[model samples]
Target: MAGRSCRNSIPVAFLVAVLFVLNPPTGVKSDSSDHRYKTNEDVPLYANKVGPFHNPSETYRYFDLPFCSPAHVKEKKEALGEVLNGDRLVVAPYNLEFLSNKDSEIVCQKKLSKEEVAQFRNAVAKDYYFQMYYDDLPLWGFLGKVDKEGKADPSEYKYYLFKHLHFEIAYNKDRVIEINARTDSNALVDITEDKEVDVDFMYSVKWKETDIPFEKRMDKFQSSSLPHHLEIHWFSIINSCVTVLLLTGFLATILMRVLKNDFVKYAHDEEAADDQEESGWKYIHGDVFRYPKYKSLLAASLGSGSQLFTLTIFIFILALVGVFYPYNRGALFTALVVVYALTSGIAGYTAASFYCQLEGTNWVRNLLLTGGLFCGPLLLTFCFLNTVAIAYSATAALPFGTIVVIFLIWALVTSPLLVLGGIAGKNSKAEFQAPCRTTKYPREIPPLPWYRGTLPQMAMAGFLPFSAIYIELYYIFASVWGHRIYTIYSILFIVFIILIIVTAFITVALTYFQLAAEDHEWWWRSFLCGGSTGLFIYGYCLYYYYARSDMSGFMQTSFFFGYMACVCYGFFLMLGTVGFRAALFFVRHIYRSIKCE
Candidate 1:
């Protein structure tokens, strides 16, 4: 026994050593900051170029920043031009002016005339900000600082930062605009006895001209990032993989050896052959698929879970293959929304099928619930967040038209898809197949020990899955809140696969233990066991907010938690579905393999 223990220890020790080597504490850290301007490539500015532009009918109108001129402050129309003959239109560039430094204080040499100054003041009064693009990056330049009360500060000076812009000509006539810029107005100044202070300013603009196709331009922007030494995710990946391997090994061992022994003993029970007395899980095979209580709710949850699962897999695959590459701002959010909308049919189908199997008659209600269960909370949260943004006059707020369009998409596209899928599912299957006949009386569950109880098992099961993704979670939070770009979709995709495997394996193990303990109720328990990971994830979000992020402001806080709630909800559905499906398969395989009367 001692020697066998030592032999087992060797593999465990080897795994630990490999993980340590792969993910050293001081391994290279990758930054997704823009590095396009760092190169020596000459970017050209064309003054003769003119392009057609138009806003999507469903999208909010984007107003450009007002540029002050001698005649008046020019407010560029959001509708620049339209695509002609399936070709993208390129716009002419703005004239450039240089600033000079005198006595360590930088000043604009070409000062605006009195008329131009008046126009500039008018532009400021109208709250117009300059909008430009550099290589598919959008740069929004603010001329003044606004207070928390949404008022522009009178005493603060405005600083301008400029960088190169890149434009992509798309085949579909969708224009690609990119701008790179950053501003810093905070610098220490010395005040003398007379209370006079000296201040300095810095500003520059770089332009790069490229005729790259719209697709390639996006690819370039997404691929562009600061120099980094190595990917540190290898450590997290290895850690998660090791965990999954161990859990899978345990599950496989039990299924093959322990369950096989039980089957053999049951098969050879000659004394009870006439009476056909069964033991263990075989005793409950008849009731295992007897349709869980709260059938509609459970079906809805499963359907939504299936939808989210499919959406997640497809999104990751697209991202991994560079479909969302070039890191356009808001691209990820847009993709998720669109994909979820398109996948509503999957949710409806699963829910209807399950509900029908459970002998439910209210198909319409089930379909509605399936669509609303997850989306309802999300929409409400978004509305509240958008309201707060509008109150603060922040750019984050979606326009009323955009909001209406989103509702229309949900109502018109997603809702119909759900109905269609539900109809198909209900018509196809009404009765679920069970391995054995369910007894009229439900089996009485035995009281479990503390460790095997629902709460304890869920709490323990959740932590392992959470541990696998906590490291990646940090990077995701940084990208969202810390104004950093996350371009490593390949790593993200791998970690996501690991997370699903971990959730499934742990759920199966916990479900088996519960069944072994004579707990016939595994439906909700299996879902909760896997879904509890979301709770742990939310806890980590709290830690990230207070300890990792420098975020402040009530609006920011509201947005963070509101969006996080939606995220956690989706995670619960996805992971819970994974757990339930795995457990269902395990139960079916085990019961079907045994001899039963």
Candidate 2:
């Protein structure tokens, strides 16, 4: 045992070092800390990606449109996380001096050809918005506006491009605190013509001094729409708390009153019990401990669930501790991907141990299944989505080098750790222990009523848990799918706990009822019962897609459903494991107290 412990510590220590090196204190802000500047230091402005307002994920390079570029056309080298978030920051033509104001100055004169005009017209029709960064402060402006008023026919609709920009830069001491870009409707040019057009792009800069510190500058960008978000978040938290309390009440009632009575009744000798009644879960002691069929899959699912649950808690803790913030683009994704890969050992160890307990001998196959169970489907989905993004020429498509690096990380680091954990699990295995001995032959399950059937029980088991978190789900969906930023990790963590508790309680109740119905097949049923919450969540996703969101088009639709499917599938695994373990403990306790033979 000491040798095994020592061996495990080595890899764990290495993992910690690797994590520290990979994720430093560096935040989503630009690497440049040259905030303190003289009166006339040249501050370069970089333009980012542009995308349709409705489809946030489907973005293209800013220069993809017929926009004027700098004479040098220099691109800023972005971090891996930034690139993953589809940020393409390139130096723009507009040059500004610190604390210096400029009047309406012509940025560049451009003669747009027929193709360029068509591209601009298309961009305007889609309501594309552009983003730019000056001194690490982001600014946004629309490419054009659609005038729907005074137009009877759809074909007669007018598109007007905003040719001029007004920039406001706020400074405190020597630091740039805030920056904003605004377009005037008066300076709009009619882009309804498809022929060549000569346009002069113009911009004005106004500098203002303030007492606001540089550290607090990002707070303004946090949430402009906070009151509504706070109200909904509080409501959801209260709703989840009430649901958890009710579930706990049910558990307490069952454990204290009902189970206590059953324990006393069953404690009597067999003859005395037979004289009164021999019904309920106590009758199925012999078959309840029987190894479930397809136990390999169950083990793998449990292992994956364990990994996901830990990953979630760890990330939330990191978020709470300020490792990442809402403004940090791709930081969360980068952490999730890295942590999941590093924690492959946990999944392997868990799967191997459970499989061993079930008397499984195909260790190699079990290891492979444990490794690929979740990653296989996720990889396939990502690949398909990436292909679609590439075809659409969207910035969401990962570069070939990035893809190769990710693959290498998984292949080199994740795989070896999985094998090591599997080896340790196999070596430290113990025989399965059950309070009640299983009979050689399985017991026949009696006919159950409609309400007591597995499907109905599963439906009942899932609904309560889903109801607990459905409100929170809306906010989560909005933040991910829409433009809302999710900064409420504390609330999310609480709701997550409530969800696990609700799932465990509901699943255990169902398992108890199933056993009482003389159905000893509680293993897979308990898992599926808890996991059914994911089904309810997926159903809600359908409702949210149609009712709640304005998200349209093939790319956005596919991205939403595909990624949401993966998330819901993860919920299924994590909650299913919680249910299975809870039910197993409940069954063991009750059987042990009753003196199962």
Candidate 3:
């Protein structure tokens, strides 16, 4: 009985080992005081409160600030924040005009006409907000009473204002644009009832005598803004590497041994010219490549999967090269949108080609399905979340004009690319090379044991893939949902490679088991087995929301889950593609090696 208990415990012990390797606990203490906000001693005190200081070296270019117009304005317009409804309204390009001169000071005050004041009132009524960038950090301006500890009280929140706009331009050797702002009694404007508000602007310039290079100052600003987690990131990567190496060694050894034995047996049988054959995967070669029943859906999945695969690879490569560094607000989102739009051609070509090979006739329908499959769900979710954000007066909500721009990008740019790719794919010949000819009727799959069934196999296959990334996922969640700054793209790239390998190996292992059980219908099973990792990831998100995060608002919750759904969908596509390709290669290699004429 003791020996029997020991044997039963072996599987549990192995599972615990894998879990430990995947999530090695960091030695750092989890004390709340460690992360509490600390007052920077270097910051200058104003009225017993410390205010943010300007880093002269870092300069940033300003973009258009989004404003919602009242029912009077025929169309909404986006403009520079400095020009909108500030104490000192200034126009674009000229807003930073001070940067052109090295040692000059000028003060100009402009009075707004009745029409302009009325427009400003209308903008305030419609909840106009400013988007300000200094260096790479986003600056948010709010009007409220400040407490003794330098904290603004939410109860005293009155209105939104862009108080002080200071531009510092240096021309020692090269031109640079630097900006910093401070709030004072004179800069505050109360717009609670949306009445006609007059605006007057005064400019004061001060030059600091310093010899620091602009690049060095910019580097200093970046370092201060973003969090530094190099040690923790390396620790997580080492753990993940160990897990991946173990999995790789185990898979390589098992596959080689099994394949070698099978090859030897088959070769010996061929030499003896035996009529009878083995009773495993060799018997199912004729039906292994049989087209699945839902060919169109399968084709669409493969196409979208391939498109996401390409997008993820390119985005990571760009990030590794520092293209989407945190210094640029919204740069990553812009890059993803542009890349996804351009890669629509790849999606179209893949879907059309696969559908054609499946004997599909409607090229137009296939093309539409391929493009809409992933984008449709994403757009719908985004629209729903945007609505919630707008209702809550959240700055994260996108304006209608921006939505139109996104629509135009999808329709004008992405649609044309998809059409071009579909035309090319439809005109090309469909060549599917199968060693054994498919039978007229589908092969009957045998009854699988409960442990080997679809759900169980998917659960087992998904756990390892999810485990490989759950540690990194925690950091990502903190970055997205908390105040953490994530800048470990190199480690992310490494973990991504590991995720692909683990998914591929596990899918191959699961496929082998299914085939050995005389179950040849693996088209969807292979995809789902590995793709289920996304389901696990979604579950973890739920856990984080309830257990780890302090989020409580309805809008925040809705937006979080809404965007997470889209994330999981992309993960499903990517991992599903990896699993399908791996299984396909496994099946083809196994059948091609056997003499099944």
> lDDT: which candidate is best?
2
Q: Could you give me the TM-score of model 3 versus the true structure?
A: 0.70
lDDT over C-alpha atoms for residue 488 of model 1 = 78
**Superposed Cα RMSD, model 1:** 13.0
Writing each residue's lDDT as its tens digit, candidate 3 over 1-597 gives 999999976744543343233222211111121222222211110110011111111111112122221233221122211111111111222223322322222233334444544444434333333334322223333222332244376444444333344444332233222444433455644543335554444334343334665445444433313444666667778887888789778887897798788778776777875676656776787788898878888888888999999888877765665554443324455556767887889888888888898789888998999989999999899788777756754445565656776789798989999999888888778776677788878778877678988889889988988888888898888766654556678788888988999999999988987887778898899999978898899999999989887665576678678889999988998798889989988888888888875
TM-score of each: 0.71, 0.94, 0.70
Off by over 4 Å in 3: 1-131, 134-212, 221-228, 271-277
Candidate 2 collision pairs = none
Q: Is candidate 1 or candidate 3 better by lDDT?
A: 3
Report lDDT per candidate: 0.61, 0.83, 0.62
Candidate 1 residue-wise lDDT at 528: 90
* lDDT per residue as tens, model 2, 452-527: 8768887998898888888888877877787777787888888888888888888877787688778899999999
In terms of lDDT, model 1 sits at 0.61
When 1 and 3 are scored with TM-score, the better candidate is 1
Candidate 2 deviant stretches above 4 angstroms? 1-31, 224-228, 269-277
Candidate structures ordered by lDDT, highest first: 2, 3, 1
